[model samples]
Target: MTSTATHLTLNRTGDKQPISGFGLWKVPKESAADTVVNVLKAGYRLLDNAADYGNEKEVGDGIVRAIKEGVVKREEIFVTSKLWNTNHAKEHVRPAFERTLKDLQCDYLDLYLIHFPISLKYVDPAVRYPPEWYYDGKGPNCTLENITIRETWEAMEELVDSGLVKNIGISNFNAALIQDLLKYARIKPAVLQIEHHPYLVQQDLIDYVQKNDIAVTGYSSFGAQSYIELGVDHAIKCPPLVQHDVITAISKKHNVTPAQVLLRWATQRNIAVIPKSNNPERLASNRDVFSFNLSADEIKSISALENGHRFNDPGFFFDIPIYA
Candidate 1:
């Protein structure tokens, strides 16, 4: 079931990234391997993963099985992973990447990203891997490291120099930080991944990065779906994108699911999307977004749903308010 999905050409390496990919954010380690295999069989070539996901090992197992069974070749898949916030210091960057590469069982990553701009104190992998938010893995207290982005980015460039990562980019970065990064970045960022749904359009940031030739990848395309499972108040209180009147109307008009309409709303505008689902039917529908086109008025109607709402703010769960 190979897909004729659209591709976005990256900057330095000219690598073509799939416009629609599978995100492995909250996937449990127990089911990660099976899920990865299924998605690959369903025609997902781009796998968006991270050390923070705590399921890379299982995800890698799936990839290995998929390749061994001839579901898809390694080169046919564009594997992407991220550097966790705890591994932002210069000395920790390569070692952290090495661990991820080992876990994924890959020689090199198609795209590697600094998961977030916020730097946290390093937690040894032996102490606790994928150290999320809290320094000790148990607390209301979170510590910040003094490491600058420039230092971490320099180390990222070294990964490129070593030919381990084909392209390096940032996630959850704003325009100002991007401007600063460009001033000193020897290897320009090839992509920018952000929480972009109709509720959080972020059109200005998208326009700015796209103008610079940095492709954009949108995660959480369904808005409140992922966060509602985590008991987030903002997400719980917000309207479900799949059920929203506008989305439903558009979906009916296009004869597609609301999920497909939401994804198409982004991909139609040239922004990439990483949407995950365990249901086999939904998986195929999600990747089939490029088949239809939304009218100019429908796109505007979807964008009109923006209310500056953001569901993935670290501030909501931790002391660090990166968005604030």
Candidate 2:
């Protein structure tokens, strides 16, 4: 009578929060919603949408409908949204948050993250991709005054105090950048969401976050194979997880999809993953990962897939000099 994945376990965060869900990016902006709450009913407790994704109202609508239908309670969901680049100025943080809250139809969020370590100059939101002094058709300005990373981070801390956000996290930041934040942040960051997949696995970073008790969420677990459709040319055509000799052998041994194996690999290591698939069958299969665990040898074989390459390097963002 076990209805959930037996081996899957939720991790505790600030103030004793437990999360076992994945984030949703690329949710469609159109009318037909599959329901964010039904996703909850399917055991997804995390919805990771952002302003850049342009579907906050629909995401919020889905969640609300699910609640009204008696599918799940608001407290059971670990909702998250990020502050977009254009809003990096200290003065704009709250307004941006309020916009997100309004779109999400929620009073507070479980996690709010600084979308990137970089920043863009302030420009009117009315204009699409406002041309700024840094827009040499090149990249981010990263000027000390254009909106310092610390400035945005400090305000993020304020959100937690004001009870607008429960936990704080950072994405698109490297180890050095992460450590630098530790010097000034009063409320330590609780999670690090990164572009993780078998091919570009980051062990040292993962170990560092784990050593410090900061949770890690893996985005793009299937690798760049998924983003090629989005015009990212360098995205890897990941070795079919179900077909890779290592993954296939193990899946056969365990009677699970290569996906279950991939997820199980992360969950067993205390890493969190947010894999998305709108298809009901795929969603169910993706959620079916918690029943069993990978063997030590299976784990090592999967770990061996890493070769220190990053397919989603945000290099197109190279025109943005901040990371440079």
Candidate 3:
């Protein structure tokens, strides 16, 4: 399926990125590369990944296979990876980035992001790769790194200067935090990736970032599906968006599946979506979202589904409760 996917431009550089793509989170390492190759053949251009995801090497292999088989060129794919919490120390930043670059088999990334606002204590590379999520509470094996967001952002800015990453962005940031970041940022964040879906619309945040020219990308587009797998109590209790009557009705009206309705809802609002799938049917269905138009009434109906529900909060990791 060749795609005519919509794209959003970066704030300072004007780089246009596909509004929808295959998310590489939680993919099994053994099959990730093959899955990526298949997704590319099915028409996705954006490959959203992270170092914490622990599958960069497999993803890199898949990308290489696609190019080798004449499926797509490296320049045609927009690859994104994130710096993990443990790499928050300014000194650890470059080495951490270098590891990811080597794993992804790329000279530079299309976009690199601070995976979260909080920074954990850095563990020696000889000890462990991710160094566990130890920032919220002091553990015997890990301690607070005491690195501030400003220091981290400053280091990330230098990555741009070094041409290691073409664009830089933030993930999981709230409104006030973004405002604070913009105050001292040398280069405005090119994108804001967040957990966005009908259950957690975050419209105001989206509007604010887009107003400032930072494109927003949504993860967990299927509402509680991702969280449910993680055994999150709240997510397990919440109803799945795919089964919601409003979504199903809209899907029926459009002659598409409920999942497609959800993806279309995000894209229709100009927010990029990175929905992960290993199923061939879903891979094709997800990329084919741009073909149809959702009515203004339908879009509004889905927007009304927002309940301020967030499933990926990291407050549990810290003693100071980050999400107040």
RMSD of each: 2.5, 4.1, 3.0
Residue-wise lDDT of candidate 1 within 195-215, one digit each (tens)? 999999999999999999999
Where does candidate 2 stray beyond 4 Å? 1-19, 128-145, 236-242, 321-324
Per residue, candidate 2 scores C-alpha lDDT tens digits across 1-324 of 112232222224434333245556665656315646556778877778777777788888887888888887888777888887767888888888888888888989988888877676555556543232343435454332366778899988888889888888888788888889888988888788887877777888988876777777777777765676766655544454546788778888899887778877776776677777766676777777777878777777888998755655545634443333
Better of 2 and 3 by lDDT: 3
Arrange candidates by TM-score, highest first: which order? 1, 3, 2
Report residue 292 deviation for candidate 2 (angstroms).
Answer: 0.9
In model 1, which runs have C-alpha deviations exceeding 4 angstroms?
1-5
- Per-residue lDDT, model 2, residue 278, is 69
When 1 and 2 are scored with lDDT, the better candidate is 1
Highest lDDT scorer: 1
Question: Over 4 Å off in model 3, which ranges?
Answer: 1-5, 135-142, 317-320
lDDT score for residue 79 of model 2: 82
Candidates' TM-scores? 0.97, 0.87, 0.95
